[model samples]
Target chain A: MLEAIILTVITAATPLLLAATGELVVEKSGVLNLGVEGMMVMGAVAGFAVTVSTGSPLLGIVGGAVAGVLTSLIFAFVTLTLVANQVASGLALTLFGLGLSGLMGESFVGQPGIKLQSLDIPGLTTLPFVGKILFGQDILVYLSFAAVFGVAWFLNRTRAGLILRAVGDNHASAHALGYSVIGVRYVAVMFGGAMAGLGGAYLSVAYTPLWVENMTAGRGWIALALVVFASWMPWRAAIGAYLFGAVTVLQFHAQALGIGFPSQFLAMLPYLATVIVLVAISGNRRATLFNTPSSLGKSFVPDR
Target chain B: MMRLELVKRAEKSRLMSVLSPVFAVALTVVFAGIVFAAQGHNPLSGIWYFFLEPVTSLWGVEQLITKATPLIIIALGLSVCYLSNNWNIGAEGQLTIGAIVGSIPPILFPDFVNPLVLPLMLLMAMAGGALFALIPAKLKTSFGTNEILTSLMLVYCSNLFLDWMVRGPWRSPQGYNFPITIDFHEWAVLNAVDVGGIYLNLSAPIALVLVVILAVVMRSTLKGFEIRVLGQSPRAGSFAGFSNRRMTAFAFALSGALAGLAGMMVVMSEIGKLQPVISPGYGFTAIIVAFLGRLNPVGILIAGLVIASSYLGGEAIQTSLQMSSKLATVIQGVLLFFVLAADTLILYKVRLVTGREGEGARA
Candidate 1:
């Protein structure tokens, strides 16, 4: 039972972790893409559709990432090229993604999905609890951890990472230094979209193994909140994701145990916890100011 | 290779300001045709059924007004929030709470048939919405929390709370296991007014009156000036002694109250009783309406009708063309994208230049 519970928690946390990690990079590069939810839903539908057509979960994952990139490209064009409001454009992307995905995935609804199989090794299969807990997860679970470490290293260790941070912290100064602020931001935004797409793909291909309208069910927003809760740190975001995942899983367990509270109220725990965590993290003005990218959410137009 | 570049205009284009929304609607129509064509349907008939057919008949027109009433009311309130730079994205949650609170008079006191019951319900709903909205406002003002996330999180909570209400505590005793409440008394309802062989819901005229009032307030009131000032430049507003904290609270509360009023109107006039669900994402749809209307009261009024027609048209396509009504949602999303993209043209001119020439200019 303990191992099973832990496994479920890992599964729940993987998507949030994946999505938040990508958003962390985007924010670090001084861009706020609010269309993670939209990109993710599009990924879910595209991934599912591709998987159904080809009978390969791997292709579905790739299809999801491509769909996410395509959707995010629209956001990149409007916000970067046209210099539109990031917040409004992000919102539009989400609304559009949800609607478009619903229309595209209409035929796929209720169709049995192809679940991504878990990793298995001859020696690892017979090992103890830690082996299964650590190595038994599907490919995405392992990739999620790798993504966090990869981002942390990329943002902190690489010379290119420094330029990305420079642009996010002060785009004008970065521009003066002759770095392509828009170029760096475009890459970051697309990366974020790809990660969000993978997260959504994980839902349909691994977690539930089905396509449903808005199956993301505010998870995208929660991933956004996770970024803030982590104070924009990659590792901290992993921790936050796991904590939320635990809360999500525990709520289901509580319902199974028939804890006197209504299931609906129990379901509210994750969202309510998000609110409390946001207040706690943002309560200290100095801390928030110190961590936030100086140019976050502000639109920049390069003047020639 | 060729590239597209934007050159900032010395002055904002007055002509484009008025023409952008029109351009956006046209762009959306073009996109709708593409979407229809992709779906193996005739683009022309789909566009006609989706946009034009609804308003061509009296019944369709009445449905449009009925749908527009809540959207206009909610969007008007949201205009105050957006104008003040407070991102209150959880109007849906506020509406849910508003409907729940507003239904108290009808659900709890089923025997109260007095006309006063309706007014009391309306007042309670506004208060409830205002108070619910103040949660994010208070958090922002006191703790410097991100109102966007907090407000949105509350939406999920409020929705779940409403679900629990009808299922657990407030489930109608005589509702035969349905997650609904008893039918409201006639005095508790907002009846449709028969005007010259055409029936209009009282909420329609109420919404129109609100448009005129808000237009005047936003145009002439000192409060309106303060909101605009704060949104444009917080530093300047602060120097002018307009407290950011106070403005945040005021904007949130006002919008909340209006959303609450809209929620009450929805339940009172349309649903006639509390159910597990009362809205079809009206709160979120109002965000698009607010933007499409250019954040102006009169603009929002017209935008509301346009969006409302889309809702009716979505159903029309669903029935006639055998396409999912979600096509409307797609249209709405595309419309908003065009709106934001076109709004950029108001301040900049798009230039198409060869790659080498663009590079030379950059250097």
Candidate 2:
């Protein structure tokens, strides 16, 4: 029972973790892409469609990442190149992604997806309670952990990460220092998009192993809120993702346990928790300023 | 070796401000053609069918009006929020709660028929939406939480709440296990100006009145001036004796109230009963409407109609050309994307310069 619950939590948390980790870097670089949901759905469709057609989940995951990058490029071009409002452009990206994916997934609507199978370690699978939880999980689950560690390490220790944070903290200052603000932002946004895509791919290929319209179903938005909920820290974000994943899976458990509360209300736990967490943490000015990017959702243009 | 750069203008270009959305519309039509052609349809005809034919017919025009009514009403309120720099993207949730709250009158008082039923429903709906709006507003004002994220997250909560209400408690005895409430009687339904299978309801005129009132408010009133100033510079507004915290709550409440009324209109004027899904994402779509109208109430009236017509256009092509109904959504997204991108042209001009030549000249 314990292992099973942990499995559900990890599976549920992986997508949120993957998406939020990418967005953390994007936010660290000081660009708020509200369209993570859109890019993610686009990735979901692209990954699913590719997997369905090519009969390879590996290629499908690749397809999902590439699709996310392409979708983010639109956001990058509008917000970075044309210097449009990030909030509005990001909203547009979400709206477009949902619609385009629906249109593209027309043929694949009812088809079954190729599930991304779990890893096979020779001795790990035969071990007792700890085996599956630690080592017998899918590649994506391990990737989620790698992403958290990699991002936390990159943000605090690396020079490139420092430059990314510097650019996010103050674009004008970063420009004065001769770092390519646009270039760094472009790369960051694209990376954010790719991660978001992988998150979506996992949703279709591994989580449900099916093609459904709006499959991401506001997970992207939850992931966005999770970033704020975590104060944009990678480790905290992973924990938040797991907590949220537990909340999401709780709906099914409530139905099974015959909890008196309506299942729909139970299903609303994650979103409500996000709002509550955001409201709760918002009072900490020090945390807000220290961890939150100052230039988030603000448009930056080089004056020189 | 020509390089392109965007130069900021001293003043926003008057002509570009007007032409910006037009350019966006034009760009959307062209890209829409590419999308349709990619889907194995004739590009030009698809454009005409998708963009033009919807507005060309009387039925189409009426359908456009029906869809635009709630959108205009909602966008009018969002215009207020946008002008005041308060982001309340959870209009969908407000709409849902409004529908649920508005249904209370006719749902409970099925046999209590009175002349005041519809008006009471409208009042309750607007109030419920405002109350829901206040959640995020209060959070922002009191705790300094981000309204955009909070309000949007609340939308999901409201949606689930509505789903639960309709499915668990409010589910009609005769609903046969379906997650829908009982249908509203005549007292609850908004009387329509029905002609040729088209509905011209009181919602349109009510929306029109709001447009006029808000347009004037934005143009002349001191409160309106405060909202504009607050949006442009919070520091300046603070110096001018305006409190942003109060304004934040006020803007959200005002917008939320309008969103509530819009939600009531959807139920009273169209659906006539509460269900699991009350809105077709009108709250989010209204954001696009607010922006396309440039956040002007009067402009929202026109912009809402165009977007509503595009919705009809999606349906039009779906039936006529067998295209997917999602086309309208795609076009709306494309339209918003371009509209935002075009907004840059108002404050900046694109110029081409030779990069190496400039370096050589400097040398």
Candidate 3:
């Protein structure tokens, strides 16, 4: 029972971790993409549609990433090129993605989805508790770990990562250094979109194995808060994602135990926890300021 | 030789600012026409139906106003927040709570029918929404938390809370297991007025009056000037002795009250009782309406009408053309994208400059 609970928590956390990790990079690069929900829904639809058409979950995931990248490119064009308000444009992107995905996925409703199978190890399969909790998880969970490692290394160790952080830290100063601020932002935003898409794909292809309109629900929004909850750190974001995942799964588990609370109140647990955690994280000024991207959400337009 | 370039203006153009929305609307028609064509429909007629069919008839126009009423009220409040640079994206949640809280009067006291009853219900709604909105505002002002995140997170909480209430505690005793409430008493309802050949409500006129009053106040009042000043430069606002903290609370409370009022109107006039949802994305859509109207009261009034038509038209097109109603959201999203992109024109101009095209032709 313990292992099963841990496994459910891990599954719940994977998508949030994936999406929040990508957004952490984007925020660190001085851009805030609020369309994670939109990109995610689009990714969900694209992955499901591709899987239904070709019977390959792998291609569906790739399709999901491509769809996300494309959607983010629209945002990048408006915000980065046209220098529109980032918040407004991001909101618009989300509304657009939700609508577009709904229209696209109308035909895919109730269709059985192709699930991404987990790795099957011979001896570990029969091992008491730890086997299924760690080894038996699907490919996406493993990819989430790899994403955290890669993003941590890229943001901290690489010269390129340092440059990206510098741009996010001070766009004006970075522009003065002759680094391509817009170029770097475009890349970062697309990466955020792709990861959000992959997260969405994970939802349809693995988590639920079905396509429902707005399948990502408010997970996209939660991922946005998680970036702040993690204080913009990659590894911390992983911990925060799992922590939230635990809260999400705990509510369902509690209900199963006949805790006597109405299920509706139980369903509200994740969102309430998000608000409380956001308040706590945001309460510390100096610490938040230290990790916050100085140029986060501010538009960057290079002088002609 | 020709290439496209954008040049920032020395000062924002008054003419461009006014024309930008018109230009955006025109651009949306053109784009939407292409979308219609892609969907295998006649582009021209589709555009016409998409934009105009909703308001062509008296009933349709009334429907437009019905849809626009809540949007205008909510956006009216949101304008204050946006102008003061406070991002309160949880108006949807605020509306839900307003409906939830306001329902208590009708549910618990279904027998109360007095002249003051309707007014009291609405007042409770304002209190509910304002109080809910203050959670984020208080956190933002006191703890330095990001209001945008806090507010949005609360939206999810409100959605679930409403779901819980209607599904459990507040469910109508005779609702037959459906997650809904008992029908509101006559005193708790906002009666619709039949003006000539159409059905209209008291909400429209009240919303219109509020918009006008707000417009005048925002233009002439000292507080309005303070809000604008604070929005443009918080430093100058501090120098002017207008506290940012106070402004934050004021802006949030004001908006929340308005959003709550909008919710009450929706419940009283439209739904007639508390249910799982009273406003269908009215809170979120009002954000778009607020921006589309340039965050001005009069502007919001006009933007509200335009957006309201889209909602009606989406339903019309869905049934007529056999397409998904989600097209309305697509239209809204596209219009907003263009509007945001076009709004930059108010501050800048696109110039077609000389390039190497002629040289390439000569070669």
Candidate 4:
């Protein structure tokens, strides 16, 4: 039972970790992409449809990524070139993605989805308790951890990272220093979109292995909150995702254990935690300053 | 030939206001047709179902009003919030609380036929929604917290609470173990009448009246002027001695109240009972309606009806064409994008250079 619970946490946290890490990068570049949910849904539908048709998980991943980036491009156009409000455009993107995916994936409902195979290491598989819990997981789960460290190194140690940060902190200053602020933002936003798509792929190919409309079930929003909870740090995002994963996994765990509570209350537990975390992190002056990306949702329009 | 620029010193252009929406609708219809064709469907048939089917039938018209009522009510409140440059994304949560609260009176006093009961429910729903809105409002005022996140996050919790109550404490004993509540009595329902044997709910007229009243208030009232000033220029508003904190609270509370009333009307008029899904995304969709209406109450009234027609048409298409009901949602979303894009072009000219574009670039 303990083994199953541990396995569930790791599995559940994978999608959030991927999505939040990508968002962390996007926010660091000073662009708030509210289209994460939309991108994820697109990814979910595209991934599911590709997997069912081709019977190959590889195509599924590519399809999901393409769908995610395609969806994100709408946001990129409106916010980047048109200089529309990021928050409003993001909301619109989400609305568009949700509706589009629901229409596109309507036929794929209830069909079996492609299952991502777990790693089979000989020596690690022979290990008593740890093998099944750690080594036996799918490739995506392990990639999620590597992604955490990779993003950390990318943000803290790379020259490209510095430029991105500079663009985010002050577009005017960056432009004055001969950087194409709009160009950098477009790339960052697209990268974020691609990553969100991969997260959706993980859901369809690995997690549930089935198609369901709106299956992300507000996980995209939770991933958004996880970025806030993580204080915009990559390693912290991993921890926060795991924590939320536990919160999500434990609901089912408690139900399995005959823990007496209305299922609705249990379902609401993670959202309540989100509120608590937002309050706790927001109330303090230093915490808010450190966690919030300075130019998170503000639009940048160079004066003509 | 280059077009001549017309210089006019005017606050607003009547032609621009009238033409923009028509242009937007036309553009949206064209864009949506392309999308439908891409999916292997006939664009003409798509337009017929999306635009024509809902308006042609009596039942379709009723459904259109039923759909428009909630949207207009919620959008009316949201205009105030948006006008103040405050984004209350949790109207969904506020609406849920409103429905839950409003349903309480009807559930507890099943046989209560007093007119006061309905009024109290409306009051409580408004109060409940307002109280929910107050959390984000106070948080922002006192701590500078983002109302968008706080209010939005609250929605998930509120929905869960609603789900818990109906499925657990409030579940009807004789409901055959379904996760639902008792059916509301006739007294709790929104009263409607038949004129020449055509049935219509009271909410239609109420919504229309509210739109007129709000339009007048927005154009003529001191508070309305303050909201506009705050939205256009916060510094100027503060300089004028208008309390930003008070305005924030007022915007959110007023928005919440209308959302609450919307929720009450939904339960009383349409469902007549509490269900697991009390709303069909009315609160969130109203955000679209509010913007599409350009934040004008009268514009919102028309926009609400138009959007509601799309919903009916979407349902019809879903049944007849065997397409997803979500097709309507896609059309609505595309409509928003095209409309907003059109609005931009209408309000601001897009310049194109015929020659030597690089000559103008000095940076």
Q: Which candidate is the best by lDDT?
A: 1
Q: How well does candidate 2 score on lDDT at residue B348?
A: 96
TM-score for chain A in each prediction? 0.98, 0.97, 0.96, 0.95
TM-score of each: 0.99, 0.97, 0.96, 0.93
For each candidate, report its DockQ versus the true two-chain complex. Answer: 0.89, 0.72, 0.60, 0.42
Order the candidate numbers by TM-score, best to worst: 1, 2, 3, 4
Model 4: pairs clashing at backbone N, Cα or C within 3 Å:
none
Candidate 1: list runs displaced more than 4 Å: none
DockQ, 0 to 1 scale, candidate 3: 0.60
**Worst 10-residue stretch by lDDT in candidate 1 chain B?**
B193-202
On a 0 to 1 TM-score scale, where does candidate 4 land against the true structure?
Answer: 0.93
Tell me the spans in candidate 3 whose CA falls farther than 4 Å from its real position: A121-130, B1-5, B351-363
lDDT (0-100) at residue B88 of candidate 2?
Answer: 88
Query: What's each prediction's clash count?
Result: 0, 0, 0, 0
TM-score of 2: 0.97
Q: What is the lDDT of residue A8 in candidate 2?
A: 95
Mind giving the per-residue lDDT tens digits that candidate 4 earns over B246-337? 99999999999889889888888887877778898898889889888988998899899888887887887777666677878887887777
Q: Residues A190-301, candidate 1, lDDT per residue (tens digit)? A: 9999999999999999899899999998888999999999888999999999999999999999999999989998999999999999999987789889989999988888
Write one digit per residue (lDDT tens) for candidate 2, span B1-363.
Answer: 775568899999999999998898899888989988988999999988877888887777877888898999899888888888898899998888877887888888789788899899889988898889999999988898888888988898898998888887788999898888898888888887877667688888898899999989889999999999999999999999999988988888777888888888888777778887878889999999999999988778989998998888888798989988888898899999989999999999976768886456434
Deviation (Å) of A258 in candidate 4: 1.2
| Native interface contacts retained, candidate 4 | 0.51
Selected candidate, larger DockQ, 1 vs 4: 1
Model 2, residue B39: distance off in Å is 2.5
